[model samples]
Target: MLTDLHKQLLNDFQRDFPLVERPYLEIANRLGVSEDEVLSALAELRDNRLISRVGPVIPPNQIGASMLVAMAVPEPELQRIADIVSRFPEVNHNYEREHRFNLWFVAVASTTDHLARVLDSIERETGYLTQRLPLVNDFFIDLGFRLDLSHA
Candidate 1:
């Protein structure tokens, strides 16, 4: 179970961890805790899988290029293919999309050619044809779900 202080810190700074030189110090000061405590609590939360990551989530097309690629991986070989897909630095997120192309992943690249190279490499490695779906039009969907303070 998390202490109240940890919960408060998570609620306050989950979206925006400051980009200042001493980010942990700033957060610690705001939360009335030591920088070490903040770091420890974050580590604990991550270890427990309460949070996926504690960093900036830059939107697609903001800096580097991104695409939603999927592959029709066999169900028996999903985990193996997923592991192969995760080896690439270009892949930031992966999911099992429910469609003909079941293995969906986001690939961020320096250029279009770089992204294509990743796709080609995956095709060669996994022997599965990748379907790259570069965003033609993006709709910003807010998937924000507040942690239940009542449970906290």
Candidate 2:
């Protein structure tokens, strides 16, 4: 269950996150709490799986090259191959989907060549071919979600 402070933390800071040296302190000041309290609350939220992470969502191709890679992994080898793919620092988000391409992930690298090498390594290591789909254009980018903690 979320408290009012937690609800405020989630809804209010979804955007315009403080860009100060002591960001948590800034948030704490705004929320009328100590910096340690803010940090502890965020840690608690993470531990409870109420939030995935607290960070900036950089636009694709803004910082580096990124691609959506999919693999048609066998059911028995899904977990093993997924683990191998997740080991790469380039692989940021990986999950299983209900499709022929059961395993899907997003990989970002410092350059296109680096992204290609990462994909190649994944293929070589996993012994599974990957379909790399580079971003053509961004239609919509929504990273914010509404958490109705009022009921909590």
Candidate 3:
């Protein structure tokens, strides 16, 4: 069952916690709890896989460059290729998508050229060709949705 505290935390995230020096403290204050409690709750959520990470959602284009690279990973070499890709420091997130290009990953770089080079390195190491898709134009569409726990 989702506790009242968990529900409040989710609601707060959907509304944007705060933009301040001590954001956690602010959230704790609002929740009528101590800062330690707030921190502990967040940690518990992450440990239980309810929340991934509590951090700023930084836009790659604004700070640096990022590209979505997809690889046509053969079934036999899937694990080996994934291991090679994960070794690259530039690769932030990697996943297997339901498509011909099974292995999908994002490599954030200092620049567009750097991003390309990172992809090239992956191709060289994995011996798997990559299809690089850099965001030419970005449209930020907020997809934040509140989870329903009433049934629970």
Candidate 4:
């Protein structure tokens, strides 16, 4: 069960998260809670799988190279392959699709050469071929979600 604080933590910080040195303290002050409470609630949220991470969303390929990669993985091997891919720090997130190329992930690295090397390493480790799709155009996709907790 989520308390009001948990919902606020998720909803409020989706945008304009503090960039200050003591970010949790700032959040705690705004919420009228102690810094420890904010920290504890965040840990609880993560431990319960309500949230995956708290981090900045950089614009695609602005500071680094990124590619959308697909792999035609066998059904039985999907979980194993996904685990291997997720282990790479370069991979942001991966998901399944109902297509021949069933697994897809976005990989970001400091340089194009580094990105390619990471992809090559993934191919070598997973024993699967990767179809790299570089972005040709930019799109504005809103990635934030407001947790409507009125009924909760």
Best by lDDT: 4
Residue 128 CA displacement from its true place in model 2, Å:
2.5
Candidate 3 positional error at 53, Å: 2.7
Tens digit of lDDT per residue, candidate 2, span 38-123? 89888988889887778987789999899999999989999999999999999999999999899999999999999999999999
What does candidate 4's lDDT look like per residue over 41-103, in tens digits? 999999998888877877789998999999999999999999999999999979999999999
Clashing pairs in 2: none
Query: lDDT by residue for model 3 over 1-152, one digit each (tens)?
Result: 56677777865676486899998899989889999988888888788888778766665688888888888887888988999999999998999877789999989988888888888888888888989887887666654666876763
CA RMSD of each candidate after superposition: 3.3, 2.8, 2.4, 3.4
Candidate 1 vs candidate 2: which has greater lDDT?
2
Candidate 1 vs. true structure, TM-score: 0.70
lDDT of each: 0.84, 0.90, 0.82, 0.92
Tens-digit lDDT track of model 1 for 25-54: 998898788999889998988888888878
Off by over 4 Å in 2: 20-39, 47-49, 141-143
Q: Is candidate 3 or candidate 4 better by TM-score?
A: 3
lDDT of 2: 0.90
- Order by lDDT, highest first: 4, 2, 1, 3
TM-score of each: 0.70, 0.77, 0.81, 0.70
Ranked by TM-score, the better of candidates 2 and 3 is 3
